[model samples]
Target: MIQETLGHLLPELELDPHTVSALLCASAAAVAALNWMQRRRIQKKMEEARRMRDLGLQCMEKAVQRFKQQNPGADPSRILSLPLVELAEKLKEGSLSAESVLYTYVDKALAVTRELNCLRHVIPECEGQLRDLQGQKEKGLLHGVPVSIKDHIGYKGHLSTCGFAPFLGPPEQENSVLVQVLKHQGAIPFAITNVPQSLFNYDCSNAIFGQTLNPWDHRKSPGGSSGGEGALIAAGGSILGFGSDLGGSIRLPSSFCGLCGLKPTVTGAIGPMAQDVGGLALCMRALLGDALFQLDPTVPPIPFNEKLFCASTPLRIGYYETDGYFLLPPCMRRAVRETGELLQEAGHTVSPAVPTSCSEAASLLSPAAAALQGCIVFMVAQDLVDPGLKPQVNCYRIPVLVKKILALLVRPLVSPSSGQLQVFYGSLPTLSPQAYRTEFIAKWKKLQLDVVLCPVLGPAFTLGYPGKLLAAVSSTMLYNVLDFPAGVVPVTTVTEADEEELLHYRGHYDDAWDRRLRKVRAVGLPVAVQCVALPWQEELCLRFMKEVETLACERKKCT
Candidate 1:
């Protein structure tokens, strides 16, 4: 009788409650099965990582415990102190062999690994890699350079787990295109670094390889995705490293770790097709230029334009103190303002500039949507992500109707800036990438600016805090949204004074970011400024970055 009545009603109403209930139940069961499989996969992957980590620890401990004599002529300190360019020059001149350089870095890396937990996979094949370079007649472009790779990038026979549990199994059969290019240029990638689970969050902690701490302060994260590279470089374990940046991954970590990182703008001129390319092709396009498309015919055949890098005269510099969304803390704003002043003092024309639609882009990239969906999808399809992200994932999964009801029923009784409402609104995202870029470029060119100075998402905050400040990413995410070349230069360290200024911050909005700013106490952390240039202007970007670095370096030395 119920079936007959339902059939008649379904034909009449275009829907049946019983059929809808049945479909929902089936969908729920399928999702549950997916979740179960994912959990099992993660457990296995976790065990694999744990065993490897233990092995790495034991090897490192044994090396330290044994009285191993240092190379009679190798001064690890002098070797470590030379700039990468000078070291490459020395290697080319035959003063340094690739082997010695490799060992020095390996030893340095092992020592620091115990403290930071930055490396996810230490290449046990280091000896094999060194051997291949032994008899080369001419030193390659990166001869003797020891490079660290982000874990997500592939290398032959190494699993690029990407910090996802179900992503385990099958080590890659071939090197990522970028890795191949680096090797062809004589760079030896000796280690793969850690990343946050899902590579979405800023904190460099994951359930697979554990947390990577800031070398400057244990209380803080090293910044993430490319976070391990940041920590390793900051700890002096590697002279150079490669990392991917979506928004601020490379630049933020570089800022927090007090190192220089270049995020070359994706231009059509000369780079192996970059935008939307993932895994190895992106890195190759970034460092080697688009000339490598011969190796990858799928790549956009653009070559790196060498001429655009030159700034023949002083640049017209544009500077901004905030992203018009999250107002920066005093230290972060000071870094940008000071850098602008220094450029002006050096005879560059400095003026105010802003990205008109960046905030709208940031809204589109709201973490509540991207991060929550990523975590949930990863949670349901593969292994669940980190426990730290559980709260966010759970909240995002709440039905939109439920959220609206909560806003109506619960918001009036709670604080206006409640997390629930903010999350709900932010989860409703909208993006127009191509349109935003077109508008941004037109506005930027009208300003006639060679480079723009800004902050790297405020100063590195305490660990566990950045995830909460996802909205604060407008400062860095704007450039990413624009796909302009950008770099980070550390300008100052936090002083006791900077921490107290938050209590009295009177610049802009007095919202939750302000409240969180007031509670932050991350003194001694490095403050960094980001230098940005229009697409394909990496050379100019690097030069401006150098100017900031030189000024900052000289000032610190004098003090």
Candidate 2:
């Protein structure tokens, strides 16, 4: 019976018995050869990576030891105490040399990078750059300043993989606009930091460089896709760093890591010397100049006004704690409230405002935009993801088919709840082009609050929980949809009393989300809030943020 069955199935198998045996043998040999080749390649790559990592680590260790040896009485607290602006001033007046400043920061940054996995590549070339800049007669504002950039921002002749391994050999022939600007201003690009695989998610995890942890708390996340920049800056590794934001990439990381970041109004700060993709260039032009400038060059150029940063009066501030979809985590809620109170105390008019359903708008806009763009996001993700996560990648690649099969098979047994269904459904929409585009456009239009203040997410949850609160990202994505400038300010830490308040809370929206909230409450996380300004109103946003920071300082002093 077995022989007869095999004979019947043999025709469908498309090989004669002898041929199949021979083919199998050949395939086995081929697979063995391929495996050997792969093993050799992996071993070579690992050896190179190890050498680079070890060299960086050893150099940093020596630098730190030498610094301490030279200045035995130097205050260790100086590492964490001084802000970058003051450090820059000190470096300018001959009080600090380029060597001393760079050594100190490089030492600190390298140490932090080792601890947090924040760096993709550290440039030994920076030491030379610093020495050369110091010898120059004319020094720019950022002269001798050490700055780290996000990996996505290209640096000439340096590896610009943007966290993908395939692009890891050397720098680009031309620098990105921001990089060129930084170099022109005497900012040394010493290192490039890690990013999310697709530069989309808030969690800073990639297979190439791994995860970057929060400097304040190791087990928690530092925001992403500019997360490494946030961690490095906060850890006192770099006096100043450059980060790009689309959604809450820059602001979220800055907030999580307790550092200040500025996301300039679209094109208000762009320079012409660097290369930019058309969409970004267009976006920048739209925000900085006239929309008609796209068609006609005869339009007057609208340069970035320096006066915007030095505005005398505080502007009207609009604030909210939650945006209906998800409640603010205590830390984020406190940050927003404290910021609002501070602005009010500082004599800025503060008004409570509720933002409309921006998440719904984002949900609507994603489908249509994704469809129109021909699923570029998916393709980018596929290209960047590590082979180790191939299964996860496949789910995203064929989301509709895979999700339906998953829903029919796995979901029923594993996640029978409606909430789980919603979560599952969220992943499936990426597969539908028209659905993604329609959702994206509608979502964009729906989030129309004029300078809204909201939470970046719930309170600072631990590292592994970012996916759980993915929906909460709607707060940040709303501004991304509107192309507005949003800034995050750290307000306060979670207190025992805050935990107590949460203990008795009942589920308001749904039992599942409420349970997630309660789990978050148990963590005792820090709180921060986002203050968003209309496009090109970054100055106003910063002014409001300063007021909020002041209030937070006062509250701390009182406590």
Candidate 3:
């Protein structure tokens, strides 16, 4: 059949067999050349990445040697264990030199990166920063403290490679406003951490820099786009670090790593993560200072409000165990319950809070929404998309009618009430963005709540599940759309009882995502609850987080 059809077409075109063969040969060679060129380009990027990694490691070695010679028989572990505020106080009081703190963290950061593949590029200029700080008459708040930043945050003469090959171009000419604020406050920006490709997935892995593993367990994910910051800080590589969150990027990783983190009410918001809540407060105080306001005039000219943060007055706090959109795991529900009970014991009015009946808020604010909004342009013309992000991109490229049909077909197979169906069903706008935001804000006002307590998400899933479990983030996503300040505080660890609960787990809808989530070996993982406040109430949010941290610590001692 093929010969007869070709034979007739060839004769009608009046082309000989040799002509057809030649055309086919030319097409094959063209394809081969394109493939060769693409391979060379990626090779060049990898070479540069290695060069940067090696240079940072070499700088680390020199600093560590110098530190040992300067302070003979000093225990690095002792310094490593100190919280951010204590470390800063030591530096200011002259008991610990700025050089000693810098060198100690640099050494630990190197070890953490070696074990977890977290650091994207270590800033060798931290030594210069120390020298400059020493010459100053009045030291700033974060005096001589070493800090790690997300890979996408800008620094002078460094590539802000957001884990994409094509982003490997000329370095940024100057530090971003946030970085400038850190430096002015005497904080040394020492390292940049890894992120998922295009900052698209909650799980951190990209083709260029590879994957970043959890410090608690190598098999599980740390969470992204701030996964590296979470992993590094959890391993005690840095006392304080900064990461941006669009949708649970900062909160999820922080919860997974058993660290405290915040997501402010700003788009592409940059906030701090630390092992203790005090560290977060210090970082927030520094970021909201006069320096930040001057560098970025668009930012509110509000300095850190000490009165609001330190007020002992009780707050009317609302709590929720589930969002009704996605099923909450038993451990997650327990985290919220325990947090509420702790708050009540401390004299706060804690009550249940329910959101309006619209569940599409998270779907509209998710990474998939960013893809449909044209944020993934850098992903085009690449060698390949990471497996975690490929599904969202394909969903974006699918035809509208086809998506509707696919959504219908996927419903029964995944779950009758699975939140994953939103990806396909969201092909058309469901609600006005403004209307959704107003409804949630109205609920908050009606309840007269100063803050809300809820689960950050089911404790970190196994690596590579972030792409599949987008709906699980609904508990955290509502605040993102409302532009409210939200934070995560580690309240408990996954218990033997929690693990037992998982064996009998069937979600509200018995969803496929829940079944897959229950299979994650998270027996010993940390479980945390999210704390949220109204817009511009970051300090209040941090205050609530600190209260949770204090209660959890006391509870642990009693246990």
Candidate 4:
């Protein structure tokens, strides 16, 4: 096609065949030369990253060895096993030295990342921070706790690459406000974990830092952009870490990794991830302290509400087994079912409360909301020039009429479980925002619900599934659109029964997506449910999560 076009156009321009051939050859040669130079530059950057990573690993190893030599009989396993609150207590009471705890976690983090490829850089300044912290008379809420942070959250003298090659450059001169607040709380930031390129994708892989694998099953993704923090913490590398979430970045990873995570209503809010709800609560309390607000005035100065978090009054709870759009896997539905039953058993007034379809709500609430997804993909494509995101990029690049026609062509091939038609229908909003919000809030007021329970996603999806199944994120996207404070709690693990049930699964729409979701090899992976509350009620969200965590534990014991 190119040759034919050039042949006709060249004749019109009065160009000869020989001259055209010469020009084409020269252009090809220049392109090849540029490609070679670009490849060479990429290689150099990759090598520098490798060297930095190696040096960081070596420093961590030497620090671990030094600690072992100093505390010959120390039981690092015991220290590593302690929950965040317990560990903090131990450190504050002097029962466990801060150095000993730091080294123990560092040693474990080294092992975890080697297997999972989660960590990007180990903070070498931790030892110095420890020394300074010990000299202080006051012990903060997180005194001496070793914490991990997601890749984009800045630390001094370290590159905040966000898994993109071009971002590999001079290290940050000063710590970001989040890191400074952590340090002020006496927490040591030991490492910065990996992220998907540009912090946009749900899968935790990129051109520069490679991929982060699930700790539960390497065949599956750990979930992103907080995937590294989830994998590392789930593997017992770090007890407490911070991950930012706008959609389900924090909660999805936590659900996949069998950890607890929270996402606040604040835009681009950074939240806590840990093995238990208590850890998240503790971290949330510290993050909401005066230190954070004072350090960054943009933060709402609302201190953590102890009364809301500590209240034992039974909540009027709303629960749903599935969102209207996606066909949730059997395990996901089971998690919601069992969690609601447990919450009911615990005396919370659990009632059926299925809100409007997420896509519908998004259309009514924000007409150009779907464009945000496209915009994010475009930014990632621009930043990385990486091929992993090319499929999504290409989809967005196509004309809208073409996309609609393609969707129509594939409608017959899709199963009913995919709800493809509903998705399109939802895109065309019929109700006003006031009408929709009023109706939803009426259900809320009628139920007098304190929190709502739902599924986070289908399950810990198989590796490479997220990129193909972007629509599945609609389950969590609704809460994000509404700016609700949401949290995830592990209710149970996928059982043999759940896998058997999947064989007969027919999603809400019996399309390729539903079939693919059914085919995911997810037996034995952890299943979790989302807990959501009104905007700025993060403490209440955490409190509801804590209650669910307690009930889940008791149910496990009884089983």
For each candidate in turn, give its C-alpha RMSD to the true structure in angstroms.
7.0, 7.1, 2.5, 3.0
Model 3's lDDT to the true fold?
Answer: 0.83
**TM-score of each model, paired residue for residue:** 0.83, 0.77, 0.94, 0.92
Give the distance in Å from residue 288's predicted Cα in candidate 1 to where it truly belongs.
2.8
User: Relative to the unseen true structure, what is the C-alpha lDDT of residue 549 in candidate 3, on a scale of 0 to 100?
Assistant: 89
Q: What is the alpha-carbon lDDT of model 1 when measured against the actual structure? A: 0.70
Q: Write the per-residue lDDT of candidate 2 for residues 1-559, one digit (tens) a residue.
A: 5445556778877766667667768999999998777656654654575477668767767866887799776654573455555555666676766666667777788878889888877777786686678567876656666778887777777666555544556658887766655655566778788876666567787666678888878878887768888788777777666677766677777767766555655522221111111211222332343433443354335643436544666566667777765565555666677677776777767787665444444554445434523343454433444432343344355555555675566445533223233343442332243444355445434653335566776454567566455555667766665556666766777788778767765433444555666765434445667776766565556555555666777888998
Cα TM-score of candidate 4: 0.92
lDDT of each: 0.70, 0.61, 0.83, 0.82
lDDT of 2: 0.61
Q: Please, what are the lDDT tens digits per residue for candidate 3 over residues 1-559?
A: 5445566778978777667767878999999999889978886887787687788788778878887897897778888988889998998787888887788888899999999999998888888888898798888888899999999999999889888777888999999999998888888999999998878678898877788999998888999889999999999998899999887889989988999999988866999999988988888888898888888887899988999898879989998888877777789899899889988999999999987643667655643574543556445446456776666566556655676787667666654334556554552346676788777888889999999988888577788888777677777777777788999999888988988988888776566777777776688889999999989999899899888889999999999
- Residue-level lDDT tens digits of model 1 in 353-458: 8757445666555544555564556564456557655545565676666766765675465454333234444423344677777877788789887788887864
Q: Model 2, which residues run further than 4 Å from truth?
A: 1-6, 9-43, 60-80, 267-307, 312-314, 368-395, 401-450, 501-517, 521-525
Clashing residue pairs, backbone N/CA/C < 3 A, model 1: 38-382, 270-302, 270-303, 270-304, 271-290, 272-290
Error of 4 at 533 (Å): 1.1
Where does model 3 exceed 4 Å of error?
A: 1-13, 366-380, 387-397, 405-419, 427-429
Ranking by TM-score: 3, 4, 1, 2
